[model samples]
Target: MSNSKGRHRKEYHEPKISEIEKLVSSFRSAHGHDKLMDSLRSILGEKPKTLHKAKKEDTKGSAEPKISELEKIFQHFKEIHGEEKLKQSLNEATGRDNQKPHKKDKTKEHNIYVDREIKFKKVKSKDVAKDIINTAKSFYGFVREKLKYKKYRYPAIAISILMGIYLLFNLPLLYMRMNWEKPADTQKLIVKTQETVQKKMADSATLAPGEVVPAESRLIIPKINVNTPIVYANTKDEKVVQDLLHNGVVHYQDTAKPGEVGNSFITGHSSNYWWDTGKYNYVFTLLDKLERGDQAVVYYNNKKFVYTVRDKLVVEGSDMSVLAPTDTPVLSLMTCTPPGTSWKRLVVRFDITDPVFHKPETVTKENVVEVPKEKEKKPGLISRFFSFFMPN
Candidate 1:
C-alpha cells in the first residue's frame, strides 16, 4: 500500500529542480528576479495572480515612452470618441435613423465622403414650401390692392400718349418759335447781310470769264426774321432747286440781274417737301407777321439791295397775274402756305428803296508778277558746267 501511494505522489507532483532552473534562466534573460518568479507562478497556474512585481521590474529595467508619444495616444482616443459623437449627431440631424455604425478604420477614411452623401438627400415636401407660397400670394395681394384703389390706368396711358405726341411733333415747333425773334438793332442786320453777300461773291469770283454762277445765294429778311440761305432755280438741275426749296431758298425767274429794277419774283417750297427738318415748314408761318416798313435785303453779286416790305398777299400758287412785271423795282418772295400744304402761296412784295454795291478787282495774269528763280550751287567743274542761269 505504501509503494502504491508513493507512485501516485510521484506522478502528481512537479519536479522543483526543472522548475527552479527555468525560473533562474528566465530571471537572467530578463535581468529581473521578481518578474521571473511571477512568470514561473503564472506557468504553474497560480490563483489570484498580480502583475505588480512585473510592473516594478519593468520600471526598474527600462525608461517610459516620451510625453509626445503619450499625448499622441491620448489624442487618438479622443478623436475616435469625437468622430463617433459627430457621426451620431449628423445622423440625428439628417433624420437617417437606419444608418449603420461604421467601423473605426472605414469611418476615419471616409468621413468627408459620409458628410457629402448625407447632404445629397432630397428636401421633403412638408418643409416650408407652403409658407413660401403663402408669402408670395400675400405680396401679390398687397400689390393688387394698392394699384386697384389708385384708378390711374387710363390717366397714365393717356398722359403717356399725349407726351409722346408732344415730343414727336410740337417740341421742335415750340423750340423754334422761342428762338425765332428778330434782333433789336436793324443796322447790324443790313451790315451783316451785305458783308455775307460780298464775301460769298468774292469767294466765287463771279466776274471771271466762263465762271459758272452759283446756284444758291443767301438772303436776309429783317421783317419776317428769316436769315436762311436761298438758291436759284436751274431748268436742267432739279436737285439744286429741290435742295434750295427744301431749305427755304426762294426761286426767281423774272429778274436777269440780282439787283435789277424789273419785278424780281421768287418761289419756295412748303413743308410738303420731304425733309427731316424742312426749312420751309415755318417760312410762310412768319410772313404775315412782317410790317410794311421793315427792310428786306437780297444778297447777290457781292452786294445787298435793301427793300421795304410794302404789301403782303396770300394767293393761289397758279396766280400768274400776281407775278407779272411791275413798273416799280420790286422784290417778291413767294412760298407755300399752311406749312405742309401747297394749295396757296404767301407773297411778300417789297419796293427797292436802297441799293448797296461792292466792286472787287479781277485777278488776271497781267496783275500777277513773276518771281525770280534761285541760282544753283555747284561743287565741281562738271557740276558747274551742268548748272545754268534761268530767267525770272
Candidate 2:
C-alpha cells in the first residue's frame, strides 16, 4: 500500500476562467488583427509559411516548434493552476516517458484532434478546461487566417477574394438583374395583350383613355425599361416623407393626375442604400439614361396615358421649381442626381404628345420618331492634350 502510494502521489492545478478571459482581452488589444492572425496560423499549422523557411528554421533551431496559442493559453492557465499541474498536463499530452504500447491507434490528422481510434488519457477537470481553451484558440486562429492578408496565398482565400472582386466589378449588371422591371413571360404577355387590344379596336378615338389616376398608379418607360408604382406623399411626417425613398415614384397629392391639364409631378428613388427594399426603391436609378423624345407610359385606372420626354433639368435637392404648377399638360419624372446619393435631384419633363385614347394600331414602329442619344465625337490628339489640362 505504501509503495503504491509512492508511485501514484500527485495533485494537479486548476485554471481560472476569468483570468484567461482577461488575458484574451488584453491580447486582442495588444496584438490587434495581426497577432490574432499569427496565432491562428500556428493553430491551423502555419499554412502561409513556405517550405524553405520551415527547413531553415528546422536546421537553425532545436526540435522545439514556435509557441502555439495553446502554449500561450496554458502559460496563463499555469499561473492560475500552478507549475506542477501544468507540467503534468504537458507530460501527459506529450510524454517524455518510456513508451507504453496500448490498444488505441493515433489519428492520421496532423492537427491536435485525437483520432477516434485512440482513447484519450483520463484527465482531471482542469485538463478538460485546458482542452476547451485550446479549441477556442483554434477557432480564433481559423478566423484570423480567413481575414489576414497572408490568407491570399491559400487557394480558398484567393478564390474567395477573386469571386468577391468579380461580384464587386459587376455590381451595375447585378443591380439591373435584381431590379428587372418585369417578369420575362409577364412583360411579353402585356405587350402581346396590348397589341391584340389595339388590333381589335376599329377606330383610334374609341379606345378608352386609361383608368383614373390613383395613389398607387404604375408608370412604365419602354426605353429604359422602368415600371414602378406611384406613392402619394403630401404630409410632413418624417416617416411618411422618407417613404419617398422606398416608394417607386412619389407624387404630390396636390399635383395633377396623368390626364389633367396641369403638370403631374412624380419622383422616385435614384440613389440610396443598395440593400433598401421597396418596390419603388431605385425605380428611377437609370432615369438619367433617358434622352429627349423617349416615351413614358402612365397606367392609371386600367388606362394608359402616353407622354414624350422633351427636356431634363438637374437642380439642388431643395429646388421646388420642378414642382411649380404648369399650364402645359406635362409629366415630370424626378430622381436623385447620383445613382446612390441625394446631393441633387434630376427632373425629366415629358409632354403629353399622344392622346390617352390613341389606339396603337394607327401607328407604325417606323413612323414613330425617336431621338437617339448623340454620340460624342472624339477630339484629335492636339485637342485632347489641351483638354487634359483644361476643359474643351
Candidate 3:
C-alpha cells in the first residue's frame, strides 16, 4: 500500500522547470503569436520585461489596493448610469414646475371678478351722494331761467287768449256759409217775376217776341236733385245760382231769352271757397249721367218749360263753338269740365217740349187768350222788389 501511495503522489506533484517552460511555449503559440509583445509594450509604455518587474513591485503591497481599484471601477459604472437617469428625471421635473405656475396665474385672474364686485360696493355710497347733489343744482338753474323769461311769457298768453275769442265768434258764420240753405224767399221772388213776364208776353200790344225783360228766374231738375233760383245774367255779379238755368243767365248775350227759340246758355262758380263742402263739388256729376229721356224743367214768369235731354259732350274750354246757338229750340247747360279743373267744359243740351204759362186767372197752354181790360196788373212792382232779396 505504501508503494502505491508513493506513485500516486508523484503523479499529482507540482511541475518541474522544464515542464513549466513547455507549458509557457504552448500558451505563447496559441494566444501571443501575433505582435503580442508589441501590444504589451503599447499598453504598459515599456518592454514586457520591464512591465513584469513593475508588476512584481506592485504585488509587494497588500491586497487592499487591488480591492480598492476593483471597487472604483464598479463605482464608475454606477455613477454614469445614475447621472444619465438623474438628468432625464430633472428635465421631466422642470417641465412640471413650469406648468404649475401657469395654472396658478389662471386661477388668480379668475378670482379678480370677485374682487371687482367687492370694490364696487365700497364705491357706491360716495357716488350716490355726489349724483344727488348734481341733480338738485341742475333743477335750480332751470327754475331761475324760467323766472328771468317771465316778461315774454305774459305776452304769449295774451295773444293766445285773443285768438280763442275771435275764433269763437266767427265759428257760427263759417258753419252757415259752408252749408246750403233752401232759399224759400228767393223761390217766391222768382215765381212772382215769371208771372209778370208771361202777362206782358201775352198782351202783344205791350211786348214783342224777341224783347227780354230784366226779371229773375229759377230752374228745378228733380232727377239731378237741383232746385236753385236763377239770377239775372250779369258777368259783374259774383253769386252762385242754384239751378242749371241760372248758369245760362250769365251767357244771356249769347243765349236766347227765356221765352225764345235757340240755345240758352249759363255759367256759375262750382267750388273753391270756405263755404264749399263739396256738396256742389260735382253739381253736374248727376247731370253727366242723364240719359236721353231725362227731363229738365225751367220756371220763369210762374210758368214751367219742360225739356228732354238730347245729348251731352265734354270739350276743351278753348273750343267755345259748342256754346254757339244751334238751329233747334234747345236749352244748353254749360259747366267747367273735370269738376275741379277749368281746363275743359261740359255742355249738356236739351230739347224743349210743351211751354206753359201759369197766371192768376188760369193755367193756360202755349196759346195766350185776350182778357178784358178790368184786371189789374197781375204782378205789381212790390212783388218784384221783394224778389230781389231771394237766395238765388
Report the Cα lDDT for residue 25, model 1: 44
Give the candidate order by descending TM-score: 2, 1, 3
Off by over 4 Å in 2: 1-216, 234-238, 356-392
Best by TM-score: 2
Candidate number with greatest lDDT: 2
Model 1, 217-285: lDDT tens digits are 666776566776765665535466666666666565445444664677776654553555765656555
lDDT of each: 0.54, 0.61, 0.52
TM-score of 1: 0.33
Alpha-carbon lDDT of model 2: 0.61
- Can you give the TM-score per candidate against the true fold? 0.33, 0.36, 0.32
Q: What C-alpha root-mean-square deviation, in Å, does candidate 2 show against the real structure?
A: 39.9
Off by over 4 Å in 1: 1-216, 236-240, 273-275, 279-281, 356-392
When 1 and 2 are scored with lDDT, the better candidate is 2
* Model 1 residue 328 CA deviation in Å: 2.8
The digit string of per-residue lDDT tens for model 2 on 1-392 reads 87754553333234455543444444444434345445535543456342222222223324223335445566555555676765555444333222477643334332344431122343325676676566566665645544554544477677879988987887776555444333222111112122222423211112346634444578889887897786677774646766675756777768888766688988777656657666666678789999998988787655567789899989998888888887566899887888877788899999876564333353323233334344445545545444433532
Task: Give lDDT tens digits, candidate 3, residues 1-392.
Answer: 98975775565453333432343333334334233333323433445442322122223324223323323332333344454543343334333333444344655654555454455545555677665565556555544544466785677578879978876787765445444333332111112122222232231113337755334576667887876555555443334334323233344454675555677775544434456453344445456667788887666665556778888888887786876776545777777756666777778888776543333343433544443334343444445434433434
